[model samples]
Target: MDSLRAAIVDGRNTAADDDQFIERLAQLQHEHGPMVCRSIFQTLAGIDLPRDTAEDYWRQVLYRRQQLSRILGRNVDLMTAMCDFLRSETRYLPHPRLVEVDSFERIVYESMYDGLTGLFNRLYFDEAFAHQISLAKRYNTDLSVLFLDVDDFKTINDTHGHIVGDVALKKIGAIIKKTKRDSDLAARYGGEEFVLLMPHTESINAFILADRIRQEVEKEEFTAHDLTYRLTVSGGLASCPLNATEPADLLHMADSATYMAKGSGKNTICLFKKDKRRYLRVKLMQPVLIKEMGFNDSQAYEGKSKNIGIGGILFENDTPLPVGAHVQVSITGRNNAPLLLIGTIVRIESFGPNSYDIGMAFSFKEMEKIATAEIAQFLKEGA
Candidate 1:
């Protein structure tokens, strides 16, 4: 309940958006609303808020659901979180001190894009490009653009349909996102085409990245509608400082390169520069789950952590495990005992599938002395 209240305090989740919360929650469990509610109530009790206050909060949410049901003339599932929160004692609490309203609005707006594919609707790309160009000119950094077209898109679209095309786009977008560092942005230009804006990345990097994206596309296979299709992408690579002095000119140069790549051949990656880095990076996130005992009544039995990093932990799912149950995980990867952390699932996220993703503050003072750092380094370096 404290985290729930804190999230409300943060202004991202609200009792007002009860319906949306229910929808997102349902993604995790279809028929476990009651079980979910009980777990949530139990978890709420462990928080800083008084038990009576928390129960009152829950009661108010139920009352609100009843009132809403009367107004809307329908039965509201009182067990689900949003409905419960509507009746929660904290529902009427003072608003949070968040100052950045526009940031939330921007995040809501960005969620519309295919994050895996990096495609903006035709509408968003224009504005974003303009914004980047403006920033580049203000900062006096070199700005370059690369427009890419996947070769044989129609043939793939015809043979495997739009699903395969989408898969290809997503895979290619991920490749570019991994290829470029934090300074660069790539957007789905449209269809099987993508546009990249490189801030301060020289023409050499732009051309190399374009070629890499193309080669990356060329190497992947798309499976859709039960058929696998070998897919390749063609790119037109252009840049600033060499081909053009302005953003507009750079965009034009890159677009013409796309035209040239298609003209030259369908399955090749063309570059605006002859020299560039040729290494390809493939990224994959690891999932971690928890161990269940022979006898226990814990709400969640397992968790998952995504992308464990150098200095900290990466938790994706959560669960509650009592001592003696033992935390058991099953990951199919290159063989190794990944990381040896000393802490257990202390706190967890209760949102989805009744699974907890706990945050672990490492207790090992010297992980290398304990071989924890060795395992972490091995997985990171072995990769």
Candidate 2:
């Protein structure tokens, strides 16, 4: 305590020093796990430590690392940090372990497809790009990529905030999601920009979809902070087999077309003119929902949420919910009073056992601000 306070008072080390510490801590990971971390902290504190207290402290750190692992969706960095800590003491580091190709393949497949939009991701650009190359090598089918970006998205986030930004994204996502048919692939490449893969598509067809998406985004009004704003997107379309056989050539072509659109101005679509290079983006926002909850560990709590736009929620094995059953919902602090709301399962998706997601429309009134705010706060508090 005295050393920590002195360190803080003297500005010796801030709490965020975990970065450099993490590197040193990585070396001790193998021998003591999180205990090595706790021991190091105790050594720094220079206090006589109780065995039980040290154990508890280490346990808490372990829990926090595990929780972070879940959020980051990867254990590599933290695991590597611990292993490095071990190496410092022994002058030896753990050898690299080989990963199975099958595992890599599976993750790559998942990476290619966007879970939210059901389209492919930026990674799939390579997939489709390569596929096009193969086809061009053999048959002569043309493939095209339309790199579309939402314009002035920062303004949306600046004006309405991220919550509203989320709404815009979902709205735009819905629009793009519906715009593409069975043959087209769409993905939220990063923030505001989306990539579309059109197989066996002509530049004309890709432009048609691009124009439709732009117009739809422009016409649609996203409401945030009790204000409505029009949205629009800029597009750059580049075709393969016609423009270039190489993937880089296709990217360069599309990048050029996207640039021309941006250079000319806002809310317009432009296909790559063989050598142009530019990119302007479409503007959009979307909502973020808190997927997990932390209760006081009382009795089982109910989880209820209604889709603002979609039909009823799914009730199937995919969501881990049983068939024909209604769920209990607790919107954290707001549901301090039991909700008058009820939802019955009407439909289910095909995913089974892992858990079934339910398709349910609220039998009661729309949830009030308190519920939503509480949920938003819960997520913000890092709970």
Candidate 3:
């Protein structure tokens, strides 16, 4: 204690010596604990610690030291910083014996999270979305939005009662929390609808996450009235700078895509694809062999094309494929010659008990000219 007072009064130590002294002081404080240091400060300087908690007191001490160093144009010791803080007009010194009963933190948590889902509520989500959009724009980073809706949610409520529906929603919320990244923000937007905001993520990656949640929801079983049933969800994905930069526009795009997913039949994930060319979609019902890119030939599925266009193809298959899967579609071109088109499965909808309608968006990066020419020719001939 005397050595510390002498060192502070001398005040002739070099910068290196001061740093070493501060390090040793921190080591002593860590070893002996903050209460001992607080007692020492009170006995030596005759002033209370500036904050209620020991951690807060130490934090304020370091923060005030930085401020004093900047103002005085030189490094200052802990005692000097503490004395300056005690003399400051804006110091936050609370009564040591006063215990706070009403925790502001608990109130804030109640306001931010939903009562049932335990996820962020709509109000908090809106605020967080706006803040994240600002950060993404400032940092030139990517932001993705996922909009999801429960399929046949009203039916669940009407049939099994609202209690079952609520349980299903809670389960879905748990699935989302498990599937999404820690950095992602998820919120219950309203009844049976949820939204997720992903920072520094692309649209494709966001689609993968949304699809995983969809699969999990589909696999989850809900029980009520001595019966058990399954549920599914449809989702839509959009990204910043790729779809729209404005928050409202991006959300609208994702919602529109979600509506498209619902219209395409349900239990699907659709990416917001802006139709740049307004390609003519023609009805072309023909048998096509569908093969997932990363799978073997034995796993190939057969489906019939319902519509063909320059941008994409819609087909019905007995098997369902996940969204964001690369696929090769083989169809009979002019003169019955085999024409293979490389594409991606962007949407999947349950058509019947054993049938699914798959939407494949063409990827021209592999065979641009050939696939374009074949699709153009096929559409012209069909027309």
TM-score of each: 0.42, 0.42, 0.56
- Model 1 TM-score is 0.42
Which stretches of model 1 miss by more than 4 angstroms? Answer: 1-107, 110-112, 115-119, 271-383
Off by over 4 Å in 2: 1-110, 115-118, 275-383
Worst 10 residues of 3 by lDDT: 1-10
Better of 2 and 3 by TM-score: 3
Q: Against the true structure, whose TM-score is highest? A: 3
Which candidate number would show the highest lDDT if scored against the true structure? 3
What lDDT does each candidate get?
Answer: 0.54, 0.56, 0.76
Q: With candidate 3 superimposed using the best TM-score fit, by how many Å does residue 306's alpha carbon deviate from the native?
A: 7.3
Measured with C-alpha atoms, the lDDT of residue 241 in candidate 1 is: 50
Sort all candidates by lDDT, best to worst.
3, 2, 1
What's every prediction's RMSD, in angstroms? 21.2, 23.3, 13.8
- Error (Å) of candidate 2 at residue 365 is 58
Error of 2 at 319 (Å): 54
